[model samples]
Target: MKQGIHPDYHPVVFMDTTTGFKFLSGSTKSSQETVEWEDGNSYPLIRMEITSDSHPFYTGRQKFTQADGRVDRFNKKYGFTNKD
Candidate 1:
């Protein structure tokens, strides 16, 4: 609650690269990029690699680690005796 003690919470735009989706929001995070929003205003742009807009989990296409042939290879390399 002191002056100059808290970081600035200003307008920011998060851009999704994979989906090319952008939205206007506010945050304390800092960035050097500037972008003109759809409302005809400019704000600091924060480029994000992943978000709900283009995430595999939200899209229901998530991929998991392949455990079928990996277990045999791991056991052969490290001599794991436990099979169960």
Candidate 2:
């Protein structure tokens, strides 16, 4: 461990711009923005374009590739029927 060589670790707020979700965590990153937390204290606010709250993978809203309808064309060409 070294002294005076590490970035300051402090509580920071990460805000999801799309979902308006806020998360509090410790970070060495700094921001010029600030926000009042629920604890009645202000913390550095970092605005993010994407987070778990709005991410497709995390929200289970992922958009699957259509494969250019190749599967359907193959099935039709082979006269194959899909079984439910």
Q: Model 1, which residues run further than 4 Å from truth? A: 63-84
lDDT of 1 by residue, 2-83 (tens): 8989998999999998788998888999788899998899899999888888788898865344455688788989988875
Note the Cα lDDT for every prediction shown: 0.85, 0.91
Q: Candidate 1: which pairs clash?
A: none
* Residue 68 lDDT (model 2): 43
Q: Give the Cα error of residue 63 in candidate 1, in Å.
A: 5.9
Q: Residue 10 of candidate 1: its Cα lDDT?
A: 95
- List clashing residue pairs in candidate 2: none
Best by lDDT: 2
For 35-56, candidate 2 gives per-residue lDDT tens digits of 9999999999999989999888
Q: Which residues of candidate 2, in runs, are more than 4 Å off?
A: 63-84
Q: Which 10 consecutive residues of model 1 have the lowest summed lDDT?
A: 60-69
